[model samples]
Target: MTVVSSVKDLEALTLTIVNEFDAGVDRVWQLWEDPRQLERWWGPPTWPATFTDFDFTVGGEARYHMTGPEGEKAHGWWRFLAIGRPASLEIEDGFADANGEPDLSQPSGRMRVSVEDLGGGRTRMTIASHNDTVEQLQELIEMGMEEGMKEALGQIDAMLAE
Candidate 1:
């Protein structure tokens, strides 16, 4: 997501996050698309994530079971849309059970990710997710999406640095 602010109204806001990692584009891409590598940085670093039946591609699905700080389990899935190796990927995210069947009505919306080489063995990663309506955006906010993503991305950055 790129950050944009409305000059007309200070209350109108948009999220724009730009992060560069100390890793090559291909390496970062591989880490993102691979289930095993994803496990290393999919959720909060302290909690760790476990994946099941992960397939990264158009029409493919991925299931991740994350253990919370209190040891509670929650599962989620991603339905792939576009996949361009070492460049970009688009997908839909949602909550799911152990079987990877998502509730279509309560999804997290479509997310588009772009990866670019930033020279010096660095890769820039950008992610944007647009909900279907303002209601959904509010729902996402209630669900703590922003905080979760910050934690997730923070873990990713740590993995890339390592």
Candidate 2:
């Protein structure tokens, strides 16, 4: 597992996960830049993500769904707020309806992702998921956000190795 740390800071209303990859920033960047690469590891093995529309630009939206082992589907969407090539990105992530449209009933959160070259053909990726309130943060943690993300990110090392 590449995850060095997974912290849920209710004080900061953020759930942050840090991972180190045995690849350069540019190489790791492709995981997020390309929808195909992203879908390869964006969800846990039991529930794989499949992107329907991916526009990798500021203000662009990416919509996808994770199909569970039982044939159930969990929809999701991301709107890019900021994109810094090979470095950082900020996006609003949320649950979506069956049609892949934003599900307003579910809370929407902002996630900031930063990639840093650790040198020696290695890199560090820090992802901070920000919630609007402590209640919201606690709610997400209770929903197993931390564990789900850890599982989702666990597949990255294998993909990077390829």
Write down the TM-score of every candidate.
0.68, 0.79
Candidate 2 Cα deviation (angstroms), residue 4: 2.3
Q: Write the per-residue lDDT of candidate 1 for residues 46-122, one digit (tens) a residue.
A: 45678877887689888777766667666677889889988998888776764656756674667777889979987
TM match of model 2 to true structure: 0.79
Q: Between which residue pairs do clashes occur in model 2?
A: none
**What is each predicted model's overall lDDT from 0 to 1?**
0.70, 0.83
Candidate 1 versus truth, CA RMSD in Å, comes to 9.1
Candidate 1's TM-score reads: 0.68
> Looking at candidate 1, what is the lDDT of residue 69?
62
Name the regions of candidate 2 deviating beyond 4 angstroms: 133-162
Off by over 4 Å in 1: 1-14, 98-100, 133-162
